[model samples]
Target: MDIESLAPVVDSILEAAETRGGGGDRLSVSPHSFPDAVEAAAADGRVPVIAEIKPTSPTTTGERTEDSVVLAEQMVEGGATALSVLTEPSHFGGSPEALDRVREAVEVPVLRKDFILREEQLDTVAADMVLLIARFLNDLDRMVDAARERGFQVLVETHTATEVEAAIEAGADIVGVNNRDLTKLEVDLETFEEVAPTVPEDVLLVAESGIGSQRDVERMQAAGADALLVGSAIMDGDVTANTRRLVTTEGHDT
Candidate 1:
C-alpha cells in the first residue's frame, strides 16, 4: 500500500523479531506432536500446522467473547498444531491474560497476534512466534532476524506479489497471503490464485480471511497452501462441527 508510511511498521516489527528469534537456523517441529492436520498436510510429510486463535478484530472490539481461553482449548483438542492469541486491544478484544491462559492450557506453539508495532509488548510475553504483514514494513530482513534470533517463528503475511518477493528476499520461511482486502472489506479468491503459485515452493503459504466454508480450504490447498488460518466462521458456527469442517473438509467426524 503506502510504502513510505508503512515502512516503519515493518521495520519496528523486524526489530522485535530479531531481538527474540536470535541468530539461529530455521526451527522444525517433531511430527509426533501434530494431529491429522499438520501431519496430513506436510510436504513429503513435514512442516507444522500453525493453529491460530480466532481473535476479535479491533473494528469489532465491542463484540467480544467472554471466554477466549475456552475457545483456544477447544481448538487444540479439536486438532490444531499451534495456538495464536490476538493481543491487539484497539481492533481485536485481545488481552495478555487471554494469551497467557491459553498458553497454560495447551503445550503447543503460541503466537501473539497483534499489530506488533513495538518490541516491548513482545518482550513481555512468552510466545513462540509473531505475525506481521509484509506490506506494512520496510526492513523485512531485520525484523525476521529479530524474531528468528529469539527462537520464535516469524509468519510474514503478504497481500501482493511485491510483498511476497520482499518477504522471501528478507529470509522469510512461512508466508501468508490474505484474501481479505482490509480497505474494501472484501474477499477475492483471485488473491489466492495470484499469490500462491509464485511463492517459493519451500515457503509454506497460509490462506487467511474470507474462508466461510471448507471448499475455501480445498481451493487453497489445490492452489498450494499448506494450511488455513480461519476465524469468525468457526466462532460463528457450532464449535465442534466448525472445527471438524476446518480440520477435515472431507466430512470426517472429529
Candidate 2:
C-alpha cells in the first residue's frame, strides 16, 4: 500500500502552533486508564465499541445533531466502551477544544484520532489515548516510544500486512486496522477482514472505518477484532442505537 501524505495537515497545525507563540496551557492531566478500561470491557463479553465524536469530514458537510459533549455522553450511555474524537480540525472538523469537552463529559477512555507527527502534539493531547498511523511515520518506533513515555496508550493505525508488522514491532498496545484507503478515501470491509487475523492475541485489535451495521460489527468480531472504532455511521445516526448495535455483537465469533 502506498503511504498517504499527511504533511499538509501537519504543516497547517505547525503553522498555527507557531502563530500562537508556541506554549499555551496544556490539557489538564487525567488519571483515567484507557487501556485498562478497554481490556476490562472486552473481558466482560462485550464487543467494546469505541464510539467516535466527529462533527464533519473532508468528504461531506452538515451540522451534527448535537455537540461533541452531548454525543460523548450518549455514546457512553449507549454501551460504548470508549470514545474516539477527531482532533484534526482542518479536514475532519475537529479540534483540541472539542476533545477536551468530550473528555470532560465522558468517563470512558478517549482516543485522540489525528495526523500526529510530533512529540509536542502528544504532549498537548487531552485524550487518554493517541493514534499514530504507521503509514505516515518513518520512525514508528520512536514515535511509539515518545507517546508511551508521555503516559498515553498508543493506538497504532495500520492499513496492510507490512504496516501491521510495523505496528507490532513498534510495541503497539492497541492495533487499529483502518479499512478506508487514505489516498482515495474509499472503504472496503475486506481490508479489516484481511488484516485482523494477522494481529497477535496479546495486542488489542480494533477495526476502524466502514462499519455501518450490526452485520459489519459481527464480521469484524469474526475477524478477531477485540474492539471497533466507528465514526461516520455513529455520528450520522442515533449514537446510542448505533453503539448498542455494535456492542451487542460481543458474543459472535470473528
Candidate 3:
C-alpha cells in the first residue's frame, strides 16, 4: 500500500484514539527490555527472531484464528527472543486487547506494531516497545520522545537509506529496516542488505518482512541485522516449529 492508501487506516486509528480518549492508563505489565533480549540472543550466536502475532494482513493469505496468547507461548517455546503483536484492527485483524493478552502470557518483551501517527496513541500501548514509522510521520522526533517519556522503547522503521539516517537523527535507538515497500507491497531481501550498512553500529538493527527460511535468516544476520521480525511464515503453520527453524538454524547452510 502506498502512503495515500494508508489514509483510511490512519484516519480510523485517529478516530479510535479520539473516541477512547487518551486515558493514559496503560495495562499493568512488567517491563521487559526489548533491546536486551535481541542483544542476548545475538550474543549467544543465535538468530534472534522477534516472532509476530499477526492474525491477518493485506499481503498475507488466510486468517489466523488461534488465540494470540497461545501463539505467543508457542513462539517463545520455539526460542523466539521477543514477540511483535499487530494492533491495527482494520487492514490487519488485530486489536490492543490481543497485545495485552500476549504480553501477559509471555515473558519476552512485546512490541506493539501499528501505523502510529500520533503520540496520543502511545498512551494506550501496554507493550514494552512501540513502532514509529519514519515515512508516515511528519515529526519523527516528537513521537520518539513521546514514546520514551511514556517508558516505551521506540523502534523507528525505515525503508531506505535516507529514512535510516532520518530515524537516527530523530534519536531512534532501535532501527528496523522493512524490506517490503509500502508503495507496492513487494518484498526484497536485498532491501535490508542495502540499507543495513547505513544504520550506525550503536543502534540495534532489525530486518523486517520477507524472511521465511533459515537461508533468509542467515542472509539478514550476515547483513548486520541484530534481529529479524518474522510474521506470515511463522503464522502460516506450526508456529513453534517454524519459529524453531529460524532460531536454531539447524540443517541449513551457514
Candidate 4:
C-alpha cells in the first residue's frame, strides 16, 4: 500500500486538525444544527442540499471555474444550505485548507469531502461532517467511532447492496448512494436502488453523482432521499444558475 500515493496528504490534514482541536464535547453540542442537519432535513421531510466542491472528475466533463475556496464562497453566496468541500489532493485538487476556508466563510454545515482513512482524519478540525464511502466500509468502524467520539457526523456512501450492509453494520445514520463507481467511474442514476431497501428507518438517505435534473431530484426524494450530494453537476458547470435552481428547490416542503 503506497500510503504516500494518497495517504500523506491525509496525514498532513490530520496534523492540521491536531493544531486546532475539536469543537467542544459531543454530548454538549449534539443538539446543534451541524451534526443534526440530516436529522433536521429528515424530520422536516425536505431535501438537504450538499454542495460538493470538486474541481473536476473522470466521470464528468469540464473543470472547476475557479479556486475551490473561492468557489465555495460563491456556492454559499448562491444560497447553498450546506457545503461539501473536497479535501482530496490528487484527483480532486482539494485541501484541508479549502475545507477550512469554506467552513470559515459560511455558517452552514461544512462536510470534509474525501476518502477518509483512520480516526485522526475525523478529528481534524476541517469540517463538521465527514464522508465515509461504502467501498471502504470495512474500515469504517474505527473512523466512525472517531467521528462520533469527537462529536462529528458521518455520511457513509454506498454504491450497492454489499456496501449498504457494511454501512448498516457500522451504524451509519446518514447514507449516500453514489452514482459513480470509484474504480471504474461508470455512472448510473439508480445506484441508490440496491441500498434503499437496506437503509435503517431513521437514517437519512442522500443521492449522489448523476443528479443533474430537477426530475432526478424529485425521484430521489420519492425514494426516501433527504439530501443530494451534487458534485460535478454543480461544481464545474454553470455554478450560479444551477445552484440557484437547486437551493431554491431544496427543503421540498415549500
lDDT of 2 at 34: 63
User: Which model, 3 or 4, shows the larger TM-score?
Assistant: 3
As for lDDT, the candidate ahead, 1 or 3, is: 3
lDDT of each: 0.65, 0.78, 0.85, 0.67
Residue range 74-183, candidate 4, lDDT tens digits: 77666666788877665566777777777777777888787665554454454677887665434776767767776677788887777777888888878888877654
The ten-residue window of minimal lDDT in model 3 covers 1-10
Best by TM-score: 3
Cα error, candidate 2, residue 46 (Å) = 2.9
Worst-scoring 10-residue span by lDDT in model 4: 23-32
lDDT of 4 at 217: 77
Q: What lDDT score is found at residue 202 in candidate 4?
A: 80
Cα lDDT tens digits, model 2, 1-254, are 23346445444544454433211444335547766786787787677888988888764568584788988988888888899888776657787888888888878889888877666677665678889889877888999987777678889999898999999998887899999876566789999989887889888888999987888887888898878898877887788877776777444323
On a 0 to 100 scale, what is the lDDT of residue 100 in model 1? 72
Q: Write model 1 residue lDDT over 182-209, tens digit each, in one string.
A: 5555678779889888899978678877
Better of 2 and 4 by TM-score: 2
User: Which pairs, if any, clash in model 3?
Assistant: none
Task: Output the better candidate (3/4) by lDDT.
Answer: 3
Q: Which structure among the candidates has the greatest lDDT? A: 3
RMSD of each: 6.0, 3.7, 2.9, 5.9
How do all the candidates rank in terms of lDDT, highest first?
3, 2, 4, 1
Candidate 3: lDDT over CA atoms? Answer: 0.85
